[model samples]
Target: MATEKLDVEKSSVELSSSVSDINLYTLHEERAGRLVVDPEEAKIEFGEAIASKLKLSHDGTKVLWPQPTDSPNDPQNWSEGRKTLHLLIITLAAIVPDFDSGIGIASLFQLAAQYNTTTEEINNLTSNWSIFLLGPGGMIAVMLMRRYGRLPVLFWSQIFALGFLIGCTFAPDLNTFAAMRCLTAVFGTAPQVSGLYIVTDLYPFHRQARMVNLWTMGFIVSPFLSPFLFGFLVARENWRWSYGIGSMYGAVVCLLIAFFMEETKYDRGVKDVPEPQSGLRYRIETLVGITGFRMAKYRASWKEAVMSQLNIVWRPHILGILIFEGVLFGFGIGMNVTNAVFLGSPPPLGFDWTPYAIAGGYGTPIVATVMGELIGRYLNDWIMNKSIKRNNGVFEAENRLWACYLAVVLDVAGLVLLGASIQKHLSPAGLIFGWGIAQSGVMICTVAVYAYCNNCFPRYAGEVSALINMARTMGGFAVAYYQVPWAEKNGALQTFGCEAAIVAGLFFLIVPLLQVKGRSLRAKFSL
Candidate 1:
């Protein structure tokens, strides 16, 4: 029986690995062809005209697509205005879910007092349940969205998330509050995981960089901004308002999604494709969908999707990217958490910050985040485009690794400054400068790595997205769980300084390894 079980497991792995390649080949022929467009065909086919008009694909090459059916309903053929509106809705869907993450940090002291628990216990309420569950929730969302369709899963998930948010606001006890928060976490991750996939669905490779930046901005910004809003409310001893406001925002978003969000799951399988039906039954199916049990447009079974997430552990190149991102991101979160706690205390060096003051301090990094986004939006795009042009319209996954590699210097330098500021308990400006630099560096690194992943595994975009999401949340959970205690014991200089070295080392080691072996590995995984 044990041998049989082993054999079954091995077979499942093989079956799962084949699904992505099959889908890549059958559903999107051009994506499978991978930068092999012929110049003669470019002139004969309409690809050349579309390529020039839309600036699609690299210059000097035809746009490499199977050519959309020219239906107004086809997302590929949607007008720029329609696409922009959808992007706004989807970005909001991704942002609101994460506000719960840092919502209670400023109020932890008060929450602990109310429940007769330690502040550490109250802090655990955010980290242990919500942060830990985010990655798994993202994986679940990806699986469900692939099977059921993006609109129904996202619409329902946000509705449930809002209910849970309200429940969290009214919970009389910590356990009930934590349970509600866990449920919210489970549904909240749909937006981030699904939003990235939606961008891939709607935009081609040449246009993806900008949309992805816009798409991921909310995910990158929310955790940083959450404390700013909640800090003021928590300071007024009106902690419930934090969640109350979130629920209100969620309601608005859910309504918008229900009425406006379109289904993004293209290339449905023959077996799973909807048959022509009419009336109320058809309307309901069109809205909520009943095909979740069947193989989806991308052609992965439920088990295969889950396995793809699991298999991320063994992919060294991906693991390399994950480690670099995980370390930098987690350390930044640690800095934010520690800074809030450190500033709110009484001492010669401390500020004894009011809730509003804390909010103001938290807002400092928002500037840095925006600055980094602007730099990445232009500089990263320039680098990628120049590389594409230089390679004669060919693209490589490793090309974007340069941006990540360059960002590492900025990231590590900022970490050093942040550690110095914390150790000396410097002025607000010093802290702002340090935090801003660190946040900016990390943001650039994130954009670079994410763009690389999306390009490298367009066929398995959902699965790849889930892995990156999981890496991030798991890193946050681990760091948030330990950073405070560790800092309290070792001091900020030691804590952040050590973190910087780890992040830098991981980045340097992985980039060269991936550069050397990434193409071969991707080839092995391809059809």
Candidate 2:
């Protein structure tokens, strides 16, 4: 009787334990299914039931997309002041390439005179070549960043780019100047791609769009701002002074980065990683890349790093976004190039505007870009928050595309207005209004695209950024080859109208398809 009673108790305990195990398993399964609809699409659960299980943002109102580790070195946990300083440094660095490129535009006439060549030839040999290299340079920069470290790659590249800018300032001949320009672009493009990477490192998904807009404002304003300021400079002094000023700007950026920026590249996915040691030796090693090499074994192998970027290039959804962005961005570049020629050319063929007048015109895009930034800063996050609420705290990357609708409308209207104004010889105000409006639209589109792609593949943030940079630069490069000729062959009205139509049609067709089917496509062709 005693033996039987003991056996019965043992059996009862085993059954209860088994039930507990089953209950725990079921709970886990339920959480997994509810939390993520598609992992590749970054479908995250944000509110209520899972709040205690995951890391929440500081305010406790939303779940952090990347759950932070306990390590203090994690950039996500950095103090607000540190993040802001880093952002300012990166933004300034990103502005360097485009700013230098614009200096060439402002000095076009003077360069032609100095080289005994036509303005068209000077543009072709110098600015166009430099723009083409920016894409490829960004790819190389990201590869190095992945294999080495972000801080070292950025710092060294800026130093080399600064050297080349000095070369541009002192070049004695057109060939020498063109060569220097190309080299400057190759090294100068590091920050343009890396800025996005650093932003991803420093901020959560909810804040990335706003931070990206802030960083983007630097480059977006740069192209026009440089020309606006330097156009008059060139008219007073010579083109060399413009490049000299650029070199000074580059120097200032380099100093700020060297002193202030921290290495934001942290492997949060790794388990039991040791806290980074701090001291003079470690700091020196980190800055010069010795630490990166030592820690490289923890990161991807060199070959894997390079091949991963290529893989991202071929993914169907990413490829689609690249194509769409390239086409839309190409038109914006075309406008910038053509506007310079139109406003600066002699009376019969152009506006016959003085350098001062042309410089003032560039202000239109600057103001427009500012307006766009203000709207996009909060626009994407608001759209995303609403979607999350509607879907019961499940965040979908596709919701980010909603902002593009307003962007397309603005873009189309502005392009049409600019074209008609130019074709009909309308007043300067008409030109300015059209230019400002079109720029505002482009600015909004930039923010939406960057935010959406980053959300889709958070792990591959650097790769996504590099590819986007390629699409943007390569598109602009192609347009530069043909923008003026196309406008000359066809009337500006017809030319810009067709450009506007292409943007509208492509955006509507592609964006809607992505909105409805994007989740599935992401799952089917994941990185």
Candidate 3:
């Protein structure tokens, strides 16, 4: 990364050789061939350190880097082998909070007997642990992801989370125990934000659903399976074993990521058609002004970087959509998650500490994400093709709207049925079955929402997905906390009912919003 001098007027100045990977789309298709790059333009744009590879270019002003923008070796474009490995690592990392988060259900009755605490507090603690982690951890993970790269953030956060888990394993007091759970929440969720980006970076837009479906296994399956996984551990031993086991899994994944997952922060050499800038506008703009305006290559001031994200967060359009996406993702998760705890703790629904109910809560849905994703993939493809045919070989952004509509309807209906089943106070089978259907929304929305977001925002695609993930995480946190007092005041059965009502409202709103806002590829191409 060496700097070079560009002369204008009488003065010569050095500019940063570094360039962000904003043009993720242009790389040679990694599915079959070689990644080629042009260095002459590399020299013109970024000296050696910034441009890593060289391919020649003729134009003095306009330049190209022969190296594929989304090169396979680029950490973002990790191979299928490595992508699967990464998800495995994310799965193990997830097992920590996920297992410990709800595994406590098995011990709640025992704990209430021994520690003299109420079932309500123990249940609330578990639900809140899962919910609050989504928001708070995601908030912090956003900054961590921007600064450290995805793999690094996940590795370090898991290591810290494991440490917190170890502390929870032996906490002498409930306060200390709850504090440790919160700590685990803070670190355990960092991996989630990075994991989705890992999928996007490596896979093409069309193939992304399959990769995302695979990823949903970890996110959707892990939580559902965690309770059951913890149950068997609880049966063999004590609740401490549950905490200790997931923590051990965490430590192992942390080590594996540190050893295998390469740092994805390398230069991809693809960039956007920069907003019209005076020659001076090309100067590096960090948080504040353009970097080269007064100085050589400029780094964003820390304050500026922080404020940049804040600015994005505050933009009216960004904020509105963020809220919409958050509600879409968070609603099903909050409803099913909070309701699952009712499987135990409540009498008539009681167990002799059997692992069956808890296991059922988390285990059935492993296939839900896989199944939903598999189905959504076909439906999404079918809809895209149908729209193109209807448009006479042209596609509209709104072409993707059908996927969103179908997913939301699936989710809302699932929640209302699950709520009704829970309110009916049926057998373990009815509740679990209803919940299983509700959980399918995770997979449906995962593909549909993501596909929609990617279609809508082509400019900063990775960050846009990351922002959506972050928003969803924050929404989960808010709704989870909201459910706590809500459960206390109204009870769990009613809380699910409330979620149903809210989602019913959201489903109606998103359809019209998309109708007005979305334009198909032809609509855009026509312009």
Candidate 4:
């Protein structure tokens, strides 16, 4: 009996020691394989329900992932052309609503005069109503998308956004305009957050970073270009025309989504067993029809989905990413908006800088942002894969933070130059150079932060994304809200100097915290 007790104690110690081998509830597969397998499917398909033992393929060369069965209906097995089309549709969807967020800034003076309000009040259209909506709208969109799937939420949101956008174009008074704008915020912001979820669903970690860079490009570019386009357009025509054009763009995108954006939510039933062909007519019907109505195999309760979104905040790693993103994005938006104010004022050059002139100044940062995204795409992919290889096939979430570290240097240097140029009344080219560099750094930070969150919590993509959106939106609001007052009190040099320090301090503190402790934290609290 004493020997039997000794043997039992030894077995228990061995079981505890082998805990890492049993990856039961990870966001990504932890096994040493090139392909990514769906954990839930591995349980259902394999005997004894062990995820680690049930890799979908043993073939070393073929990169089979998310354990797609041979079914053509599974998005994991979708054709490259089909996936590209969906990506384009999602990218366009993001651009149109995001354009609404910044285009209003170009027409600020006109809106102030037309509404019989101060410039501060009109600024809310850009800073308050537009910026704040992105987070909450994303929250609602993610919950609904998680429950009903992505297509319905996207389709209906676009429909509502189109209606409200047109309503804003025709609104007679400030009250009506603000009301319509708020409504547009609620519905128009789906694509910004949902696209990340789709990327996680369709791509593996090795490929997700580049796809995220691609997904982020349209969103960042649209806001920068909106100011330029609407500044020119409003100068020639009515300010309302910009909103009208946006509504038309939304209408076209909605039509494309209705026809081509297939449901991407992976279902477990299609695990290993190829689905039977449903004939050409059925295939065509699904191809060009509303597919979101079809039920997913593992539908969670509504309460569960909502609870999951709320629970995202409790995750330490996710919350850390949110804070970092919020600060970076918030400061970027503040700088972009404040640049217009500074340029439009009595500058070292002259006070004659018209709306067109201010808008043209935006061209520098816009170009820089686009270039940064393109370059960052390649760098992000290379860094993440290289790190994975070096770590012996174990991909650490911290691998993405290397980009952020480099971005911090660029952002701080650019801020110092921008502040000094403003104080010395330097040439427009000087301001342009600083703004371009700062904006590029911000772009890199955005992509890196987003990729980190997505890689860390791919299963909770919707919740993670919505939270990040909310954090950044809140950050944008806080910065934009206080910017004019702060700059007014301390001057641009002091204000931007403070910004540079704050960003550097936050990056230094948070990046190290996440790098050293993030994995253990994630392990303790599995998503």
TM per candidate: 0.86, 0.91, 0.72, 0.86
Error of 4 at 121 (Å): 1.8
> CA shift at 213, candidate 2, in angstroms?
1.1
RMSD (Cα, Å) of model 2: 4.9
Q: In terms of TM-score, how similar is model 4 to the real structure?
A: 0.86
Candidate 2 global CA lDDT score: 0.82
- lDDT tens digits by residue: candidate 2, 221-332: 7888788889889989978999999999999998988888888988776555455678888887888899888888888888988998898788766777788888887778
Task: State the lDDT of candidate 3 residue by residue for 172-229, as single tens digits.
Answer: 8887887887888778776555655666555544455556556555665555555657
Where is the poorest 10-residue window by lDDT in model 2? 24-33
- Highest lDDT, which number? 2
Give the clash total for candidate 1: 0
1 versus 4: better lDDT goes to:
4
Residue-wise C-alpha lDDT for candidate 4, range 1-527, written one tens digit per residue = 99999999998777666654544323244431122333443344432334444434344322334455445666766778888888888988888766777767777768887877776777665447677787899999988887667777888898998999899899998888888887887798899889997886676556677888888888877777778878888778889998888788889998898777766776543234223245565444444333433443345668877898777687787777678778888888777666666776674422347888988987887898888898798889888667756765456777788899878888888887887677677777777888888888988988998878766766677787788888877887777777766666666678778889988998988898988887787777655
CA RMSD, predictions in order: 9.1, 4.9, 11.1, 5.6
Cα lDDT listed for each candidate: 0.72, 0.82, 0.56, 0.74
User: Which regions in candidate 1 have their CA more than 4 angstroms from the true location?
Assistant: 1-67, 268-284, 291-299, 348-351
Candidate 1 at residue 134, lDDT?
82
